[model samples]
Target chain A: MTNLMRGTELARDIVLRASEKAAGYTERTGRKPCLATVIVGDDPASVTYVRMKQNRSHKAGLESRHVALPEETTTGELVAKIRELSDDPEVHGILLQHPVPRHIDERAAFEAIAPHKDVDGVTMHSFAGMSFGHSEFVSCTPGGIIRLLDAYDVEITGKHAVVIGRSPILGKPAAMLLLARDATVTICHSKTAGLPEIVRTADIVVAAVGKPKFVQGDWIKPGAVVVDAGYNEGNVGDVDFDAVTDALITPVPGGVGPTTIAVLLEQTVDAAWRELDA
Target chain B: MTNLMRGTELARDIVLRASEKAAGYTERTGRKPCLATVIVGDDPASVTYVRMKQNRSHKAGLESRHVALPEETTTGELVAKIRELSDDPEVHGILLQHPVPRHIDERAAFEAIAPHKDVDGVTMHSFAGMSFGHSEFVSCTPGGIIRLLDAYDVEITGKHAVVIGRSPILGKPAAMLLLARDATVTICHSKTAGLPEIVRTADIVVAAVGKPKFVQGDWIKPGAVVVDAGYNEGNVGDVDFDAVTDALITPVPGGVGPTTIAVLLEQTVDAAWRELDA
Candidate 1:
């Protein structure tokens, strides 16, 4: 039987738990778990994303502090702003929206956010922790993917997991997480030759190539669990959902999106609890 | 004819160049490039390794600072000592011999070495950098492997590289480096199932599993490149060198050993130049 792993329903349960935890922490510590979102150069897409995140933060009983800088802001300026939030005890989580103008050094800005406040898990410390199996927080999409796999009772140990991307935040971290769970992980990028043949050998596949419907059903092995981590234009995902004859997979629109945000909020509250307890 | 990739000959050239640079820098600035070797317990193998590194450092016209701590030294104390070396301007490189008594936390100690002086490349900073393509220094054996492949004109782009280990310093970093160079990298550990079948598909194979001749010759594809990065008892490597019929491979004794130490000395000199320039 072809099973659709519904991420939206799982996300509802996760967010609800985070909300409850946030409320209890706020009542005890006299402070709401706070998330600080930083953005530069108001691209419409980025602005919309930030607003959606802020709304979710509020609904989860957490405070959202948004910092918007001008388009011409230097990498130095951006890093300074992030550092301030990282040092602020009030901020439990720090998130800097992606594509912050090509002029700015994004890596430097990500590094500036202190590890404790790095709920988004974009910093090097978080990356090392993830690779070394001592992660405090994982990047939201990867975390959500792991949650989805576990929720569906998928066994990771001794399985072959093919991760079809190498982006630092998404594909690379996903591979590391799967490897930590005892899955023999293979990371494929655009430069990889015979990618389809490689993907066909996976017991579990993570398609994070960002191209719409990039993975066809024929590329996957029989009864493999496919995780489509790409959200492209026209409400499409990396996997062609209509083409799959039989397999457990995530759909484009309601799959991975809700869970991604849910994991972010959960980790934010988790950071708050950890910090407050300290 | 299958050519043997000789690491010893290549390493001699590398060390000679670094020695020349060290002499010029010492002549101009009146200070030798310095490496600090830290050891917690008197493990015989580790002591021999440290002494060899110090000897190589002196031969390369650099200073070797040895710090011997008691077996009862705590992780906190070890970190404090490494932190002192990290802060010292004279120490251009820091190497902490691994297996620091079963009680001490090794990860915390590795994290203590600052990225600039992390010639050993065992820290999280080094791992993240190697993974993300901004690497300052690589872990010695992996760095040597890359150098050997390049020197021997082994094409990496679009090739399948199967790394048969997952240690932080060797297999993990080696996989990251190969990925950075556009190879399709698969990381297989002890838990990996059907290991021989996976090894048979690789264009390039890195044997770092630390077992003596664990990889059988029949496991290799024809005309593949095998990097034997193991130093087991009786000078045996991970790959069974005598059994391989038609593959470019490294031998047990003279393969990765010389190049590993040579790379450390070269990087120490390189670090001195980078810091001095800064």
Candidate 2:
């Protein structure tokens, strides 16, 4: 029987720990940990994501400051807003909702957030830190995937991990994190030929291609641990969930999604503690 | 017949181009391009390395500013000196000789060099840029290796490139550079199990483990392009020079070493043009 890697359960445990930490931090510092969520020209999806993060922050006993900009906001305007929040003493962490505006330079805006308060881990500094294996904050989804793997007692060392896709935040960071853990990591992308053949040799498979059911179940090696980081429309994932019989696999709705928010909250509390201690 | 991938020839070509560029910039701006070299403590090897760089800079028609700090310089003192060079308008590029005193924090020192003046590409910003495929200056050795591969017309796209070792400067950056070129990259380090089996499967193999002759020639796949980035004591490489009958291989003494200095000089010239133009 293939075990379901229940991300919700693991996320719940992480959230509980973060909540306790948040409570203690508030008690000692006389102020709740604050995460400022900045969103520009809010697409419905981005709005929903920001709302979800705010809700989770509240549940973890952290405060949230929402900054919704106009649809026509320029990159400079957005960067200035982010810089303001980055300087604000009340803001312990900053989360810039991605896909801010089509014309806005998102990378520039991400870099505007100070490294200390980059709880979302979107900056180049954060990415380098992750690549070098000493990041204070990891991009949320990748961090969530690592936590999920750990909760399931997966031994990453000496294992061959094949990561699909090479997005800046998700795919690239995930590969680096796995490599830091001593896994022999192979990164395969769209240009990779004989993709399924390569996937068949992986002891651990991570699907972050953003395509719905892109990886067929048979492509996965039997008894391998599979992680689906893609949450497509209509509750589907990049991995064809029903097709593979794996030793462990994360489901679409309840798996990586919940854990991502959990990590965000945890990192927010972590940022607060570091800031206060310093 | 195994073709010797001569770094001397390729490096010579690059140096010639950079020389012409430097001469043109000097003519146009009324000043030669300048590279500031900072060294802490007089490790004989490091002194030799710094002198070699200075000689190469002079030959390339660039000016070199040599700063030799005391052996007892603290990390803060080192950072202060670097920051001064960073702010100097005449200094187009900066190279901090690596392996400073054991007590010094190397990463902190590397971070001190301004990103724009980081011609040696040792900064975290440079590493991130290399990983993201748009670096102004790549770490010298990895950039040299990529140039060597290109000179031989080795196809990187979709090829399996296995990189051994995970040092912050060499192995890790090499893997990132290869990945950026669309190769399927696997990073195998000291803890990697079944190392030979993994090496045997690569279309491109980079031996960087720092162990002399660690990868036997028999471990090489037939017709694979082999790059030995290791230059051990007595001029030996990580790969057994005579053991592998590969399509192309870089020898230790004249292979990676010449190209590294070539890249450093080239980037210094590039930095001069960018700074002067601005």
Candidate 3:
């Protein structure tokens, strides 16, 4: 019997707890935990992502304020807007939709989000915290992946984990998180030699290379746990799911995606609690 | 034919270039590149290390400032003194001797060093930069390891590199630098399983576990390049040197140490240039 590590159940449970906190916070402060999301351009996919996040936030008893900017927005303008939200006491957390027009300094824009309010965990400070094993928050997808593993009680310590990507927000932070958990981590990217052979050594595999079905069935060891963090255009993942056998795996659409939004809401509530305490 | 990768000659050549830059900067700006060294209590080894750095800085046409605090100094007091040096216009770089008394919060003291003056690269900002592959400065020893690799013309891209140990300033940043160079990097710590088996897989190995002669001869493969970052008591490295054969190795005493100090001085001068420009 193949075990599917479905994020749906886990995400629902996490969101339920977040909602309770949100309701309590609202009753006490007369305001719900708020996530201010900033987006540039009308990239159809990004638009859909933002809409889904906002809808989920509303359903979780949280308030999400959306800021939409034109395709021609400059880096300075975007940074100023994010900084304004960061300084606003009403805004508990901040999320900036990435891939901002290609011309804008995306890192500079990400850096503008205050560390405390960086619900999306895109800032360098958040990345450092994630790497160092101590921080107020973590990057959403990576954070969710760890929670997913813990919920399943998969062993991480002393296991060989292969992370196949080097993206600043995704692959890099995921590797760091695995390392922090006492797993021996090898980071493999496009430049890596003998890719399939390297994946064969992994007791745990995380496919985050952004390619649909990039990981072949033969690449993984039997009885290994696989976390497919890539969600491609065809509702497929980086792993060739149908060909994979004898392993626990997370499906693409209902796997990492829902848990990502769940973590965003959870962290937003956590941030509001800290802010209220202060 | 075993090739011994040495840091002594390369470090000397680097110091020569830095001395010229130091002279030019001093002639133009009327201020020598200055490194401020801070120490708490009088641990014999720590004192020797700090004094050596000061002597090297003076010989390289740089000014050296020393701050010695009592054993009873609190974290706040250490941070205050370091902050004073950080804010000083004359101090271009800051170095805090590590292993600060067990009672003190060392990370707090390290964080107090301003990013611009963090020549030793002990701050979170530098760690982020090292991970992200863009920053004006990097942790000194890790920076030196990369230079040593470059000088020897060792192939990094598409190679398997294993880093043993995960100290923030040494092993962790060394792994990041190797990853930045496009090497498939594995990080192994005390918690890792099957140690000798993992060491056999590396095309390049960095031993930074702070143990004397921990790695044995049979643990490494022939033609592998080993960079010993360990400088344990009695001047022994983590790798058992005499027992190894058919591999390029760096000697314990004359290997990583010189290059580490060279990178510190070079970055100090580079920081001075930026300060003078400003």
Candidate 4:
């Protein structure tokens, strides 16, 4: 029997708690917890994603305010809008949809959001804090992955964790969080040589490469807990799910993707509580 | 016959060039390269280290301004003095001697040094920049170690590099630097499990555990390049030099220690040059 690492069920549990907290916060503050989502350009996928997130926030008893920008928006213009939201005490969290126009400096836009309100945790301040094991908002995807691990009661401390892929959002931050937990962390990327040898020794494998089924079953050690954070086109993942016979694995569609939104909402409520307290 | 990595010799070359550049900058700018040395209290080791560094700087034709505070100095007082040096045009670089006092917040003092004058690069700004592959002055000892690696032409790209130890100044920063070079980087600390197995698979091993002969010979893969960055008591190193019969290794007493001073001088000259050019 293939043991599945179920993310959807765990996320449902987290979201239910977040919704309760958000409702309590609204009762105390006399205003709903608010998330400001700023999306630039007219990419269809980005629009759909923003709409979906907004819908989820509403369902969770939190409010999302949308700020739409034209495709020709300049970097300065985008940063200005983000700064306004960052300074607005009424807005508890800020979410800037990715894939801003190629002309704009995306990093600068991300950095404009204040650290306290960066619930999405895309800014360098949050990244640095998380890397150093300090108390700060973690990147949503990695945060969700860690939550899943904790929910499953995976013993991370003193384990050999191999993280494949090095993207700033997923692989790199995930490794940092794991290292902070006392795990011996190894980060592999496109330039990494002897990838299979490294993968074969891991107690935990986090496959985050965007390519479909890039990590084979032979690469996994016996009884290792595998977390596939990849969700590629056609609903495929970075790890070959069918290849691993007895190990615990997270499936593609219901795995990390579903849990990310859960983490995002949870952090939003946290940010709201902090802001209200402050 | 065993191949030994000559870290002292390489460091000497760097120091010579650095001294020459310092001299040139003094001639052009009519001021010597000056490093402000801030010492919180009079710990015997700290006193000796400060004097040794000042003596080296003077021999290299750089001026050393000493600010020795009393043991009762508060964090704010120390920060004020560091800020004075940070704003002083005469000070090209600043080095606050570490291990201030049990009562004082060391990180607060580190953050006081301005990035432009942070020749030692102990600030969070430097660490963040290094992690993101940006051009910033690196932590001195780790920066010097990287220079040693480059001088030896040890291939870093696509290599399985294992780093033991996780101090902010040494192991952690070194791991980030190696990761920046496209190496598959693994960080093992005191809490790491199965360290021997991990080290056995590395193409390149950096031992900075601060324990004498902690890593044995059989743990090294054949033909792997080993860097011993540890300086333990009695002039012994982290790696057991006598254990590895054929691998290239850096000798403890003469290796990474000398390179530390070299990097400090080089960065001081670099800061002076930036001032002169500006």
Which runs in model 3 stand beyond 4 Å of their true positions? none
Report how far off residue B186 is in candidate 1 (Å).
Answer: 0.5
Residue by residue across B1-278, what tens digits does model 1's lDDT show? 45698988999999999999999889988999999999988998899999999999998899999999999999999999999999999999999998789999999999999999999889998999999999568999999999999999999999999999999999999999999999999999999999999999999999999999999989999999999999998888999888899899998788888999999999999999999798
Single-chain TM-score of chain A, each candidate: 0.98, 0.98, 0.98, 0.96
TM-score of each: 0.99, 0.97, 0.99, 0.93
Which digits, one per residue and each the tens of the lDDT, describe model 4 over residues A71-180?
99999999999999999978989999987899999888998999999998887778777877888899898998888889889999999999998876788889889999
Worst 10 residues of 2 chain A by lDDT: A98-107
DockQ of each: 0.91, 0.82, 0.90, 0.71
Fraction of native Cα contacts kept in each candidate? 0.89, 0.76, 0.87, 0.71
**lDDT score, candidate 2:** 0.92
The positional error of residue B252 in candidate 1, measured at the CA in angstroms, is: 1.0
- lDDT, model 1: 0.93
Task: Tell me the TM-score for chain B of model 2.
Answer: 0.98
Task: Kindly list the per-residue Cα lDDT of model 2 for residues B181-261, writing each as its tens digit.
Answer: 999998999778888988988999998889999999889988989999998889899999888775589988899889999
In model 2, which runs have C-alpha deviations exceeding 4 angstroms?
A: none
For all candidates in order, the CA lDDT equals 0.93, 0.92, 0.93, 0.88
What's the ranking of the predictions by lDDT, best on top?
A: 1, 3, 2, 4
For all predictions in the order shown, the interface RMSD in Å is 0.5, 0.8, 0.6, 1.0
Candidate 2 global TM-score: 0.97
Candidate 4 stretches greater than 4 Å from native: B272-278
Pairwise lDDT winner, candidates 2 and 3? 3
Chain B of candidate 4 versus the native chain B: what TM-score?
A: 0.95
